[model samples]
Target: MSERSFEGKAVLVTGGSRGIGAAVARRFGSLGAHVAVGYRSGRDAAEALCAEIGAAGGTAVAVAGDVAVPAQAQAMVGRAHDAFGRLDVLVNAAGVGPYLPLAEIDEAHCRAIFDTNVLGTIMLTQAAAPLLPSPGGRIVHFASRLAFNPLPTSSVYSASKAAVVTLVHGFARELGPRGITVNAVAPGVIETDMTADILRERGEQILAATPLRRIGQPDDVAGVVTFLASADAGWVTGRTIIADGGLN
Candidate 1:
């Protein structure tokens, strides 16, 4: 693809301050898309990323909001649309994963994971639907390999991601009539602060299991997301593209 394949596009990426979200935002910005980097807490990181993109001749803005909240999701979408005059892509990357056994899962734990990983995605997509132009808009969500591979001590996280996959399917059908395509990327063992502890604890085992014998990186997943957001993926929808290095 050309460096400016996404020229004139505007994208709102929740959790764009760090990890996979940060990589996705930067990738889109570098491809000439105006980006709105939404962060729940990492204001400094978000602002820094926006500045870096701007300095590189890309347009971007730092948007602060919690995707888990309906009001904040609305405002975040509104701000991005107001800034760019339209919306073309929505990347739902904000999520929390607390690895815990099923026996230890509690109401609070379920609420936290589901609210952010599932509800937040739905809310933001709903908020951005009207802004997205028919026959061209895209929605990309983040899932996890664990959703299907399932492992010990990841009940809540896995279930939440499974929910995301189901949501993508439903939304793809519902939005297809509007010419919007919805898809997801399921990553495995990505190297990010969120997964640092797991990588340290099970790095060898993960590598051994992966056919590629390597842990995934944020950019690895970002590339798939960029594809789903591009015009090349116009006919693709309701699919979860896995970026797990063949770990599953």
Candidate 2:
């Protein structure tokens, strides 16, 4: 394992049933990595993805867990580690982003957003830090371009992702000595099931604002996530690579 080829590496991707997380999982599977497709309620979709990866000559399995729960978070990591015998990468793509005006923000809304986006990320990293290989451990969290440039009704959601960026900064410093790299990929409006409404309502506005003149796809962000997990990005940490086609 001196060279640490991308093949045979074990990767756990939370919220991987559909959307950006699914794209990241598929990317790793295509690279010959053993993928743990972690999902909350989309068991069927997760299992389907696993089958797809397997059909394509890669290894994958669907693991169910709610990342916001500390016990569940720990179990998710443990499950992936037990399955592969060694964990090399952890991608915390489990998150929620529901835009609400400040006046409409309720305790439940705040809790739901932060519990998944902020706390889930921290809990997963905490569980993964010890198991990940020292020289090759990789952790990538899902942040958002809104964290830096918030939209009108995105206060709570934006704040949650902002917390992810700060976590990367703190975790990168703490985990550097062990040779693990922690980073975030803050993607712009990626076309996914979760963002279908936003796309339908604000399609024109978003397109005009985006330099690329098109909404981002999951694979677009997946590429950046895989790079951050690769040996090529060993020296990169504590940074949020905004994958917005230069929207930020």
Candidate 3:
């Protein structure tokens, strides 16, 4: 695809302050899309990313909001539209890790994971649907390798991601008539802060399981997302593109 394939488009990435979210935001911005970086915290990191994009001559704005809340999710979409006049793509990349056993999973942990990973995706998609132009719009959600095969202490996180995959299918079906595509990327063992602790502890085990013998990175998944968001993926929708380094 041309470097300017996404030029004149508007893209929004939630939880884009750091890690995978940050990478996704930058990738889209670099493609000439007016990007919106949505964050719940890490104001400094968010601001720095926006500045970096600006310095690179990419259009970007950092918007702070919690995805778990409906109002906040709406606000994120609103801000993206307000900034760029339209929203051509919405990427739900905001997520949290809760690596506890099923027995140890409490109400709070379950609620938090579900609210942000599931409900937040729905709310954000709904808010951006109208802004998506007919015949060319995309919605990408983040899933995990654990959705296919869960680890011992990651039941909650795995379940939440599984829900995301399910939502992707349903949304794609619902939006197909309008020419909107919905999909997901299931990444494995990315080198990010959220999994820093896990990597330090189980890096070897993960590497051994992955056929590539390496952990995935934010850009590894971001590349796939960028593809799904582009015109090249016009016929792709309601699909989960797994980027797990052959771990599963």
Candidate 4:
């Protein structure tokens, strides 16, 4: 609604160099939120995003860390507070997807995906939760439609996201008494670099199943994430809002 609704708020977005994460960073920054874009790699893109936000008169800083590591996750939050004043919203958009069939899914691959999608979320949330302001502090994690659909070769990824939704529900209950809200956004078949090939192959089938009959954009999901992290969503907590265009 208002352009400066997030004025004075500070947000940390992980994996914010590109795709949905990048869109989320821009959306929050544009709304007057001081943004910290956290990236594991893709330094150039992360810097560019920070520059773009700065050009738009939004405060932003780029921080690099591997979400898979708890220390790194904490450092990312530390940098955000060091740059801005404190953290208001934490968006766990850092995740990894490995498209391997259930039978072929190796322990190493599964561990890698879970490390980023689940454990990383836990670590980041634990690090930022205390720093968040009580009344309207928010935490939003990115789950996936795959959690429900059980796609052909995404066993590990789907399981990890399912865990994320559970984590949201549990943390919301744990943090509710403290006045901090925890929630999640589950996206389906968004048109991002991660879904390029799937979009090319099963695009028709996916579109047909989606009542909206269209592939979603990163911004489509980002808008919902910003709402979840804002004061407007103060009453909502623990639930995972599905942004799948009716695919699920």
Candidate 5:
């Protein structure tokens, strides 16, 4: 791909301060796209990422918002649109995964998971839809392998992700008339702060099950996300690409 393949395009990545979100933002910036790194609390980290992208001769800005809130989601999208003059891609990487067994899963726990993972994705997509250019906008959502291959103590997280995949399918059909493509990526056991504790607790079993015999890196997921946002993926929509290294 050309270094400037994404030139003139603007991307908004939620939870872009760290982990897979950060990697996605960096990849888009590296490809000559203007990036808006949206964060909930990691202000310093988000700013640092923006600086790093800037140092690499790319355009990036850090925007703060809590994705679970409708107003905040709208503001984040508005800020990115105002800053870049246009929005081409929206990556919903902001999510929360809390492992709770069915016996212990309560309404509060379920609400928290759904609000952040499902509702957040919906709100952001709603807010960005008007700003996205017609006939070529892209929407990439973050799902998880657990959505398909569920495990114990992850009922809420798994269900929320399953909802995300369904939402992507519905949105793809609704948004297809506008020329916008919607898709989701299901990443399995990536090496990020979010998965550090889990890896320490179940790394051996997880690695043994994975055909690759190793944990995935954030960039492994980010690369697929970048491709989904590229023009080459124009014909693809309403599908979830699994990035689990054959763990299933």
Candidate 6:
């Protein structure tokens, strides 16, 4: 694809204020796409990203809403559509991954993870699917490597991501006739705020196991997302790209 291949496209990235979501938004913005940076709480970060994109000769807006809430998720997509008039891509990157042992995993904790990771993806897709242009719509979701290789504390979080992988298959088939592709990226141990503690505690151990001999970065995963959203991936759907730096 050309450097500015996404020119004239509009993207809405949930959880776009920081981490992988922010990188995805920036990638889209740099490629000439208008972006909607959706965030649940990081208003300052979200607006700053928008300002940065605008200063760099791109268009972006900070949209605030809780993806875990169905009404809020719909309204968030609606807000993005209002900002750009059309939605070409929907990136569902909003998620939580707090780890807890099975014994300590209460109903509240499990619900929180599922509500955000699973339900949020569904609600956002439902809202954006109609607005996306037929024969070219793209939906990229953020799953996790834990869904494939789980740790003891990852019981709940892994289950949530597994649900996402299943949804990708189901939604892709449901939306295939419309030419809207649904897919996911499962990242492993990316160096983001979400993984700082894990890296600090076991960075060396992880690097030793990873064939790439290093940790993953937000941009590393972001590139995969943008590809899935780009024209090159038109015939690809219901797939999960593993972005683990070969750790698994």
The Cα local distance difference test for each model comes to 0.92, 0.92, 0.91, 0.92, 0.93, 0.94
lDDT of 6 by residue, 57-78 (tens): 9999999999999999999999
Candidate 4 per-residue lDDT, tens place, 1-248, comes to 58898998899999999999999999999999999999998899999999999999999999999999999999999999888888999998998886997788788998899899999989999999889998779999999988877778887899899999999999999999999999999998899889999999889998889999889999999999988987889999999998999884
Worst 10 residues of 6 by lDDT: 239-248
TM-score of each predicted structure versus truth? 0.98, 0.97, 0.98, 0.98, 0.98, 0.99
Query: Taking the tens digit of each residue's C-alpha lDDT, what string does model 5 give over 1-248?
Result: 67788998999999999999999999999999999999999999999999999999999999999998889999999999999999999999998987988889899998889999999999999998888889999999999999997889987899999999999999999999999999999999999988888999989998998998889998989889999999999999999999989885
Clashes counted in candidate 6 amount to: 0
Q: Candidate 5: which stretches are off by over 4 Å?
A: none
lDDT: which is higher, 1 or 6? 6
Clash pairs detected, candidate 2 = none
Candidate 2 lDDT tens digits, 47-132: 99999999999999898899889899999999999998999999999999888888999999999998889889989999999999
Candidate 4 RMSD computed on C-alpha atoms after optimal superposition onto the true structure = 1.0
- Candidate 3 root-mean-square deviation in Å: 0.9
For model 3 the TM-score comes to 0.98
| Candidate 2 C-alpha error for residue 218, in Å | 0.3
Score residue 149 of candidate 1 by CA lDDT: 78
Tell me the spans in candidate 3 whose CA falls farther than 4 Å from its real position.
none
Candidate 6, residue 208: the lDDT equals 96
For TM-score, candidate 1 versus 2, the one ahead is 1
Candidate 1: tens digits of C-alpha lDDT, residues 84-139? 99999999899898788878889999999988999898999899888899989999
> Model 4 compared with the native: what TM-score?
0.98
What would you estimate as the lDDT of candidate 6?
A: 0.94
**Tens-digit lDDT track of model 3 for 1-248:** 78888899999999899999999999988889899999998889998999999899899998889999999999889998999999899998999987887678789999999999999989999998988999898999999989988889988889899999999999999999999999999988899999999989989988888999778889888889999999999999999988988884
